[model samples]
Target: MIDNSLGEQYLRIYDELNFDNQASRRVGFCTLENYYATVMEHVGTEVLNTGIDIFGENLAEQWTVTKQILETVDREPPSEFEGILQEVKKHRGNLYHNFREDIPQRRLDAIRDVAEEWRAWLIDCAREYWDTFGAYTLEDFDYIANEINDYSQAYMGDIALKLPTIKRELDYAFRTIAKQRHRRLHYLETPDIFLYDLMPNKTSSEISKISTTYGKIGMMASKIKKGEEIDTDEGEDLMYDARNILISICEQEDPFGRTFNNLHSSE
Candidate 1:
């Protein structure tokens, strides 16, 4: 628990954090989209950038732009700040891609862990800054505000630097998963069979599709190391389809018992 007065102060900081969080999420998604959009924009740009164009004509250009944008934000604490920023960016990417309907509770717990670290760091920074400057008046808040802004900007810049690489990896992973699903559907004895129980309001067919989709993604990932082409438009399309199935599954209850009941009824 946090002290009331401190919590109030923290609330102000929290608001700023929320603002930064939303901004970070937006930046990450924009970066990912830009990466793909750049690739599809023109053949020359695509070839020059090795199929990534979101940052600029190439990775170098993208890095430069990201630096400029991040320079407008604030600074962060010295210890492992970069790692925290990367984790945040990863979560942002996961959310953006709809890879998971809800971040695993464990991941959320990890986020809280980082948030605590950030809070402690910020408090220390504030205390040190105030001690050196001697908070002579209420006007001193402006200085602190500027410090916060600078820290946020710097932290975001660091994250921006890694965005391109992250995007590429995610795209590759998605495509690979898609290809595996495409191949797996052919080998299943009953590819359309339900693998779980649907909730009271859910349909068994939807559950089966979800199960099939999960298996497909697993299959695709296994084959990714075989020097397969997993970054093409076709691959992306397959991933998109698989993701749709997964999302549908998550939206409803499990279909295990319902599937069994139907199977027995058919017999």
Candidate 2:
């Protein structure tokens, strides 16, 4: 039997490794997952049917989707692989792991614009490669390549694979913080309403950070309460405040605890 201590360490190490892969793996018809699957499949065998099976195998192997794409392709490829890869690198963090920053919908739409084109182009290239060099005819390849753009196993699964877990966690935290902070800022009017969780070992510096963050949250609430015109900067400040407060929970800091030390712990 494996030692429990060693097992714990091993699991921790493994999780960290996957966590660091934040910049690497990606999902979707336009991501490295689909690109590598199409290229390597054509390299090894004729791509038939939706490219889902090949992408699935890549996932099973725990490959970093984008890195695998780079490794499989030459210094250059005919398709816009480089462009797709660049967009992935730029937004993958914000879209997937960046719970700290709420990405603008317009920005996500811009990235999706490129990704959709990449998906369509990738199928085009796959068909050409299969017809010219692979063991498949033009008609056979066309049928398969066409379905690559269809709703297949690989399509959404590829993109979902990169994000779901972190996205879910980040989303929950974001909503909870937004709601609670809003309550403190407007409904309760007192800091104590939503500041129950406290870190016993919180330092003065950390408390200062929380205070500043809390003030920002309150500012957002104030705007809402006043029925004033809240602009983009104010909206972003609310998001930042919510994210910071959620972060304190993870840091085990009793935010504001240091500043109000003399008050009763219950209070």
Candidate 3:
């Protein structure tokens, strides 16, 4: 039996390793599930008569995108051999004296194996359905691929591109900081001071530059709020500067978080 302290440590390690993976896995599973359902709905009576050959090389080609999406989300499909090995280990553990040496590692390995198998099984079920009912011909594959790609692009792009969505994100950030600082949003008119106060680690010169750019953005946001016209070129420049500021700060604090290195690169 594992001691409480060791078990807790193992749990912490598992949580840390799976933090982003859990979200990615869930998203991947959901995407595959929806894809399967869509294909089945479209195929209808064609499913029973359809064979893998009917898809030609189209389904095989489309699988590239499916695999790409999974990889983008960091989804790792489980290995059947690994699952079998885990089962054998579990049976052995039951039949003989439990291996006490490195028990935490063994326990963690078993949990990871089981978790992987569970996610893989979920994805496999969807893939099986999709493979069976997805496409009747090359044309079908083309249509389905186009539809799925469009949906995926639109869904992901809207998160950061839309003004309302951006405002909501910014508002949430501000409200969170406001609560932390015990300040009200209605009274928080000067973003320059508020931002300066929050970013104490920044040099005064850097804060001054940020304040100046922020003032321009603030004015643009005000015009937007009041349904007034603004210059598109000015708005785009402000957007670039704001993004560059974030990139610069993140690059200093967390090299890994910098998505783009060229601050002056055109959007």
What would the C-alpha RMSD of candidate 3 be, to one decimal place?
Answer: 19.4
Go through the candidates in order and give the clash count of each. 19, 5, 0
Better of 1 and 2 by lDDT: 2
Better of 1 and 2 by TM-score: 2
lDDT of 2 at 41: 43
Please provide, for model 3 over 75-144, each residue's C-alpha lDDT reduced to its tens digit, 9 standing for 90 to 100. Answer: 4444653453344344434433533322233543544444434433434443344333331223432333
lDDT, candidate 2, at 228: 56
Candidate 1 on 141-239: residue-level lDDT in tens? Answer: 233233334444543232223323323433343233223122223323443432332222445766565555556555555445454544444344445
RMSD values for the candidates in order, in angstroms, are 27.2, 26.6, 19.4
Any runs in candidate 3 off by more than 4 Å, and if so which? 1-168, 177-187, 245-267
Clashes of 2: 5
Q: In model 1, how large is the Cα lDDT of residue 169?
A: 37
* Cα-based TM-score, every candidate: 0.23, 0.25, 0.29
Cα-based lDDT at residue 232, candidate 1: 46
Pairs that collide, model 3: none
Instruction: Please tell me which model should have the higher lDDT, number 2 or number 3.
Output: 3
